[model samples]
Target: MNPGDRASWNQTANADFVLVGLFGETKPATFLYMVTFIFFLLALAGNTLLIVLIRVQPRLRTPMDFFISQLSLMYLMYISMTVPKMLVGQVTGDRAISASCCGVQMFFSLNLNGEKCFLLAAMASNPYTAICRHLHYTLLMSQRVCECLLSGCWLLGMSDGFLLTPIIMSVPFSQSRKIPSFFCETPALLKLSCADISLYRTFMYVCCVLMLLIPIVVILSSYASILRLIHRMNSAEGQRKAFATCSFQLILGLFFFGAAVYTYMLPTSYHTAEKDIMIPAFYTIITPVLNPLIYNFRNKDFTGALRSTMQLGLSPRKAGNGRA
Candidate 1:
């Protein structure tokens, strides 16, 4: 082959994959991008505040709050994985992502997604122990137990990344290096492979089912038991408070797991380009923004903690001003 032809071949072999961003360069797309950027900011700030509040406030340092802080950390990491790159691509018009970098992104995204699922399931134990095993809540969910559960979730999540990333990245791509979605998601990357992936697709479907199904079972069973206990209680206010505490967790689980089931558990034949893009967007972009607001903003404890933190922050300033 000639020098130019060889160079062309090398380019084809090593070229970075280009991302088709979430929006186009039209007016509405611009508005949507702006809105998304704002959501990113809100998610970042909200999760950060929750983590800080839980750490600094003694009253908020229960098993449930410990799980909430971990969830906040997961959301913080999750949004950081995809949104910033997408926003930069929107602003700079440079959408090329190196294959190795794409693999790294996919690994972290998958790991965090798995961690959130397991963490949510683990969180269900808190409410169950709190209400049903009220006397033993502390003994059941001790600091040691909580730390072990957290460690288990992290290990399971990392195992998911380690298992899936290499398998997906091992496949050779066709000449076209464009990924249809905004990030290096599993489905989008698989669609670009030149090889037959029917077997791998089936394998992935099974993996997704096990990954999603196990936690879902745990969550449902835990909640069902809690519901039975709540129903047996005579005090109306007690029932209401118990229900309220569980509801936020149920809502968060529904949002995250429902979107995940739609994205990963369903048959690929049922997936359309538009549906694929939009559903993942709900979890990846919108859910992070909703988590902190739904989980904490409505909670009296969180708001009280926020008020106390604000007072503490302002007290020193007030004292300084009085002296001046």
Candidate 2:
């Protein structure tokens, strides 16, 4: 195809390309690909194990587990959005992603963001129930209630993904379509649009500020109060245990919030492909792996439950009572 013909074709179809630029040149393509592929595999395995553990262990059937499951599922989608494109781009240096691919990436990315917000909010509420209203915990956070909350989070996230992605992608742009990021991140996509992005930018900022900012504020405020309440406890063990609970959630929240703010708030005009990819990697990939390890595995209760479940699975003599 001649240059003019190819240009015409490019306008109609999405071009696929790799977005990671490790050095000034592309000499490290193989190394970058291998590193990314390894992380992708780790993330997939870790999140998968978390989901399976949550499902099989009846002791894990709590509100916290419900949110943890959602978070894992979102991370699975998070890795789904970026890893395949990077793999293809890495193998062949033709790292160009077409418009349709961009749309898909954008949708999943937004959905995951929304889901993260909802899950965090739900998590915050779970602690409040246990700490503030211990007597009514079971009644207030019944199975049906927890299911409704989880379903609402998913539905809200899907709605946000569908509504906002199309609005951004519909911008008329005949020139300047090189996305610097590994995937179609919101800010990067906006920067590529030919249309005036002022309003859309404002909208995204408001949505993010409301969704992210408010929840973070609420989380921090709740923890602050919880800390004071814990300090007032006369028993040394009570204080230690309460501090431990607060610390776990606080650390996880900080990681999630810090990575998110960095990714979303950076001026798209100033964003580098490397930074964009790295920030999301922290939140979506690393955080998911850490969530179960840090929160669930470290808990003595969960460990005991896991051991019991394993023992139950290994009880072969009990199985002899059943018909072959």
Q: Among all windows of ten consecutive residues in candidate 1, which has the lowest summed lDDT? A: 5-14
What are the clash counts of all predictions, listed in order?
Answer: 0, 11
RMSD of each: 2.8, 4.3
Q: Please give the CA lDDT of all the candidate structures.
A: 0.89, 0.74
Top candidate by lDDT: 1
Which digits, one per residue and each the tens of the lDDT, describe model 2 over residues 218-308?
7777677777777778999988877787788778778888888877765666566677656766776667667777777788767787788
Extract clashing residue pairs from model 1. Answer: none
Model 1 regions more than 4 Å off: 1-13, 25-27
How do the residues 42-160 of candidate 1 rate in per-residue lDDT, one tens digit apiece? 99999999999999999998888898899999989988999999999998999999988999999998899999889999999999988989999879999999999999999987887
- TM-scores, all models, native as reference: 0.94, 0.84
